[model samples]
Target: MKLAIVAVGHRQPDWISAGCSEYLKRLPPEMAARMIEIKPEPRGSKSREQLLAAERSRIDAALPASVRLIVLDEKGDDLTTLKLAGRLEQWQADGRDAALLIGGADGLDPALKARAAEKIRLSSLTLPHGLARLLLCEQLYRAVSVLKNHPYHREG
Candidate 1:
């Protein structure tokens, strides 16, 4: 099953795109993944709920069919690289596509988070959007490396 990262904020800097691309290309076909960027709703005067509602609409539209939904939240459970590797292995074994949703600056709708199969926190420290994207890609690659017993995962 392929993995899909549905994130808000479309126009990431070149380095962010390049960094994500490098790791994503390294993933094997069975763990193939893609990112879907949604345009951030204008923040001017809109309520948090309104902003989330607008963005969620786009996210739902972009999601692939029959995928297990996973959300990235600051308050979500922290997953170590090894744990992520185990989770990835299980997902692959299940043969179900996985969709990881990364919300806008305000984060995803509460109802969405509640319904997700899992909520993961990339870090305990707050990270800039670009850095967070890069880190996520890097970690996903590291997780895959661990699963395949590649030296890359241990080299660091």
Candidate 2:
């Protein structure tokens, strides 16, 4: 099964790349994640709707057809780590590609959210796009570890 993170915005700081890479490198071969960055629409004097529309197009284009789409939005389900692990385990078992969509600064388009098979939130607080990407990578690795009986996650 293939897992992909299709996110908007780029030119992130080096630290973000390093942090994401650390977890990405830890993922076992079958569950390895791919990061596909969609260039953000130039913010110069464009209305929010216009910006979002542009981003939506790019995001849609980046998505692989017939795959499970999961959008990351603040309004999405705030699943616990264990719950996320269970979901990931099921997706992996089904042998289907899964795509996680991270929206741009203005957030996801309404249509995009509607199209998502599942919408999940990484946190309640607002996070920079780069930081969100890093967090998602780490959590995916943790989920995989959990599924594999690795000692990476500890429950209280």
Candidate 3:
């Protein structure tokens, strides 16, 4: 199944790109994983509402018509690594692409969140947007590895 991580903003730190790239390259050819960076609106003195609307529009545009939307938010469900792997397996079996969405600094827009079929949270603590992208990529790789019986994931 194809998995796409749709994140807001660009020009991230080198480490973020490197880390994400590492996992993307290692992902099995049959289970495609890619990161689509959604550029945030130009920030200045714009109102909070305006900024959110603009960012939401960009995210909406990046999503593919056939993919299932999954929003990443702090308030979303927290699942174990194994459970995440199982979930992806189910998605693959259902023949649907999983599109994971990461919001901008101000968090996800209400409209976008409402449209998501599933929601996930990385952790309770807040993380930098760039770092969050890298973290998500690593976790996705780990989940896939576990599902495929790779030695990369270890459960205590």
lDDT of 1 by residue, 4-89 (tens): 98889868999899999999999999899898899999999999999999998888889888889989889888999999999998
Deviation (Å) of 44 in candidate 1: 2.5
TM-score, predicted candidate 3 vs. hidden true structure = 0.94
User: Where in model 2 is the C-alpha error above 4 Å?
Assistant: none
- What's the true lDDT of residue 11 in model 2? 76
Q: Write the per-residue lDDT of candidate 2 for residues 1-110, one digit (tens) a residue.
A: 78899988867899998898898889999987888999999999999989999999998888887889999988889998899999998888777899999988888888
Give the per-residue lDDT digits (tens) of candidate 3, residues 56-88.
988878787878889999989998889889888
Residue 119 local lDDT, model 1: 88
> Quick one: RMSD of model 2?
1.2
Clashes of 2: 0
Better of 1 and 2 by TM-score: 1
Model 3 spans > 4 angstroms off: none
Q: Give lDDT per model, in order.
A: 0.89, 0.89, 0.87
